[model samples]
Target: MGDLTMYRYDSYDQAIVDARVEEFRDQTQRRLAGQLTEDQFKPLRLMNGLYLQLHAYMLRVAIPYGTLSAAQMRVLGGIARKYDKGYGHFTTRQNLQYNWIKLSDAPDILAELAKVEMHAIQTSGNCIRNISSDQYAGVDAAEVADPRPWAELLRQWSTFHPEFTYLPRKFKIAVIAADEDRSAMRLHDIGLKLVSRDGVIGAEVYAGGGMGRTPMVAPLIRDFVTEDEIVAYLEACLRVYNRYGRRDNKYKARIKILVHEIGVEEYRRQVEEEFAHMRQQGLNPPVEELARIRAFFAPPAYETGLSDKIDRADPAFALWVDRNVAAHKAAGYAIVNISLKPQGGIPGDASAEQMELVADLADRYSLGEIRVTHAQNLVLPHVRKADLPAVWQALEEAGLAEANLDLITDIIACPGLDYCALANARAIPVAQKIAARFADPQRQRDLGELKLKISGCINACGHHHAGHIGILGVDRKGVENYQLLLGGSGAQDASLGQITGPGFSEDGVVEAIEKVTDIYLEQRQDGERFLDTYRRIGMKPFKEAIYG
Candidate 1:
């Protein structure tokens, strides 16, 4: 067993991140002192993951591949408490956003983050943003292999890559180990799935998938590309997109659009040609370098043959176990998902105390490691089944335990008009309203596995395009209007949701969602979920239920 924690920043890594921090520090002072104008400084701030939102500057910190150590998480909590409000929002991209950061204090924030070996570089730029992976990457019972090292490798390769720093639009990538794509693989600009071929495991590439004004599920671009060739292949794909991807229309600038316009076959042909060239140029790093990175992600010392039997003394504990705990590859260990969507609470909003508590919990229950899920939740990847009762008790006491993993109340929502300047409406309030509608624990259990996602704007940060029940906020004249969408999914069967008739007022949208759920409950066949029933009955029945 080696270190189970994520890869720490080496001196070279530290030098790179530290140099960036110092450079940005001077840039910040120059802007504050009016030595540089806002126009002159906008790109600089954005490159460091700083954005000027509605009321203040927002800092987006990258949690690479959604992995964090207890110390890192605690620092995040401290930053939230000291800098912004007492809470931070974990985003769909597995990053944390502090909405009230000041331009003057930004350098200090970055410096503190550097102490923990994390930075916000490429988090906001038109570059390959944070590479996300499955929260249960190493511990999943059916996991093929851990995807973090590969994601980290990509993070290194893509960070400050000169050719890609000025692409037409921002790029996102996700890597998943097994058949199950937990990171919403298909919705990214590029998705890499690890697959076994003739006893040789490699990546199955999916390109051109994105959700914005025009959402499309990415097509399979390559059946298999060996680990050695993956980096070169990705470079090839990005190069093709960089050369030909649309820059004239900002709306049509993503790689998905280029793939759509050029046809997947044509796009694949171009990528293969570029890949061949890149391979000859030695784009792939030597295998030894990757192996060194892999050592940091080696399996933790999992106590073997520790009893798999879960204690069933407490019914509440059992319920939590059933809902939040997932099976682990190690017999004695289990993967624990910590829900940020406590009933009627702001989705993915973790208060400083709660964050501190969770960090303490990870130290005690897990091996000082935590993961941020794409669905805006935290996960404790390694836990003894026997320790669950105590863990649940601690979580319950700290208000961190919410036994509604895939229930109706587990909503994915954006910061919306409350914090985002781009948003036309308030998504948090709407999600709160809907979560309150079905706050009863029993009611939630009855409406099993309903994924409701809300986006405040067309950017789809909340991933409304992939929800079983999607709500997109758009401006109608001057007021907030929301359109409901049905049948979208973010899993391996990734599909975009369809808009259901006209838009609704904030209250009306909540009512419409309630009506949709009511219809699902009434019409669903035995053992059918919300999406399953919707698939069976199509959209007409659902449309009638709401429209009528």
Candidate 2:
């Protein structure tokens, strides 16, 4: 695949990354040599996205804005095959986590990443983590504009920013240009929506939303901050949080808690004040810098006057096209969402061979660009409409074509007790059993648009709090228990899911989900989705169906 659409690292960019790899290499050597204790090396390892998981050290590699070139992806596949197991987990934050990483081999992985202009910096710890955006950033027709350029700008500004390095807690930012919130933008620490108002482009910013032990939907902090002022405004927002955010309690350290306790009105007042002061200093990047970044995301030189028609001859191909294909901004192109959630398989785990296959497919069908969706799926962002059949065929042969996009079987799940040290119960088995039960494609199509998410614990890594049918695994008096929640969403109409009565055993929870879906199937109005039906009819029916 060509590197025309991907951002290239300049000499300065290359130099800094190369330096960090060498620095981390030294740190890893010291830790291995017993010169540093576990406590001493913990923060150093975390800063580089190295985590001590349940079984091994996990290394998370950042995929900024979920965009990847074919070459970068092949390297990822290579890393999976060589360094760890022959697999890597694509995470909700648009990053890849390799679970079976070795501490001794950590620096080598970082060096491999640096070669492709990628790294794991700021993937973990109390720093601005990976900046996420809509997977269909530049291709979506409904978006106001491409948000990737702005995402890149923010990434540059926030990476190793002096003041933000030691914030009260970890901060996350998501940028979206569409009215439809595909990236769960509102659930981040800061959600920026690129908008065009009166022919002037700006951002509509939302602050302090997250899902965890306590989930809160972010409130709008500003109606509009012009593109030139967005960076300064965000800096001010962070400044307010950095100064007043809670440091006493780790539980209360997130900006969401700060925004909740101080009140949105007060937080806004402080932020506005700070923004006014910060504006004098001109913190936003130069206009030329933005233009430079934006050039990389320009639409590919598409072949014009091509037919916009797709022949859906085979029923299987037709079903896949209906579920997986989305309209692209270009006339003859389509966005192909590749589901990682195959029936009875782990949600985001992709084998090295599968990763290589996707890279190959991207090079052939797409314009050498692939996207990683927050729902734990991969996407071919710019396939021609005429090429749908061939694309589907290739995917089907490789066992990568699952016709479930947002269906009940298309679940979002975290690596639970199987790999994550903080997990209370296993998430993979529960997700697997549910997928196997609803494996029938036709049955899944019947129960349309159910966003089911699972979290091993309250960290909400799987975004369970935002699922239409959410399941949380808990430690109930030394026993693993699953609590069910209903009517949550991580969309434009965002809301937190409410818990039903008591918890259930592993198998009981699966049965409970089936019962709840049965009620939805029986009672849904014409054209209403599972979420819409739940919202309109309330939780009483679902509660009785499940609990009773």
Candidate 3:
């Protein structure tokens, strides 16, 4: 893995993963031999991250806390080349999903993943899925502390936890250590924000946030739980959800619904009661465990006295730097965001060659460390500033250098009718058309920081509810129609976007977006973005402009 500092799998970890592979291998054999019906085999396959899509099986491989080793990334690329088509889709949960996987090949894929200490466990089922954190976790300058250690702690605790294996519905959690919410922390089932008080670190907890047919932003349940007690508190939270969360109705199964229905105060009261009991039972892992995990994520040996200067003489390089690069915690080093959304290209889909190239680039410039952003982009978290030109040049040559970070073209989209079985209409094509419409770099720069998201269905996989200007693809009398949503955010000030009047055709929706942007451009005051303008004006002007 080229000397990247991360959680190394010990014997026990290795054995658990290895055993899962063999167990699943047997299951697959039985499945192929007609020993088990599709119904019988479905849940087993789902637990291993194998999904039965409309056309074929899709395998989602988790990248814990969005961290990956170069070797692990290469294996992912190899799997894409060998098993599926020549590409793989990186998901919003910081996992890689291969769409064209064969059912028989699933076991082999798991075995390959096990070789590099990665797996797809709990990626699909009603369990705490892959725990996500900031893509810039350990490296961000604004972070109070790296959230990955806490996330890793959650990973160890939740992995195959007997109590939480089958909850009312699938649960998601995000841990962010920064003032800015890059990981959509409040939009998860549980959002943990790390904070420091008088030299002690703890978490500010939020519960019951999610997006689906009925989207709701999470509300804060507790102000702070110290590092040692946080896990137990989380356990209590889950226990409460498991005990009382609606199991009869799948639609009402999510913890968000429970929190919404029973009120946050009542949920907090129950969680506190359970937490008191769990604390007596000593549910939190030993302190040494956290120390051990933290050691694995220690800062890499950064060179001393390196220059922070980069030759941004190249306008293209400068634009990429302005848009895609962020300040690293370590001076003289920078974090580079590699955009996957090439203009008119499917968002988050990377070819095997691109994956391999990124792996090579990670080994070369980023100390063999790679991060998958929830926005479906990759991050080279620890690149030397002096080496940025070379990195950007290589990325430009590979078609990975798009200077559209947070731009209108930098869309967050799900595989709609094009791939997903549950989609109402096509999301990818709408994303493509919008990207093509706002192809101008200057225009995108002028519009500024517009997070446009799309979901084909009400499931909200694309997080349309969190988008600044969101689009929902729906089925209108057997035709693809899109609805526009405005003013939603997934940041620290999290809120749900509102639907803008009515829906439109695929082509008409593109025109509607253009009109909306035009209205924002026309009405925006000093120092206001598209989102700021909407939030300030309350959607009235934009609605009138689009509807009229």
Task: Compare candidates 1 and 3 on lDDT and give the better one.
Answer: 3
Worst 10 residues of 2 by lDDT: 1-10
lDDT of 3 by residue, 413-495 (tens): 99999989999999999999999999999999999999999999999999999999999988989988899999999888798
lDDT of 2 by residue, 1-548 (tens): 36556677889889989999999999999999999999999999999999999899999999999999988899999999999889999999999999999999999999999998999998999999999999999989999999999999999899999999999999999999999999999999999999999999899999999999999999999999998888899999999999998899989999999999999999999999999899787767878898898888778898899899889889989999999999999999999999999877899989999999999988888877899999999999989999889889899988899999999888999999999999998999999999988888888998989999999999999999999999999999999999999989999999999999899999999999999989998999999999999989999998888877
Alpha-carbon lDDT, every model: 0.91, 0.93, 0.94
Model 1, range 466-519, lDDT digits (tens) per residue?
999999999999999999999999997788899999999999998998889899
Error of 2 at 439 (Å): 1.1
- Candidates in order, TM-scores: namely 0.99, 0.99, 0.99
Q: What is the C-alpha RMSD of each candidate to the true structure, in Å?
A: 1.2, 0.9, 0.8
RMSD of 1: 1.2
User: Best candidate, lDDT-wise?
Assistant: 3
Query: Sorted by lDDT, highest first, which candidate order results?
Result: 3, 2, 1
Q: Where is the poorest 10-residue window by lDDT in model 1?
A: 1-10
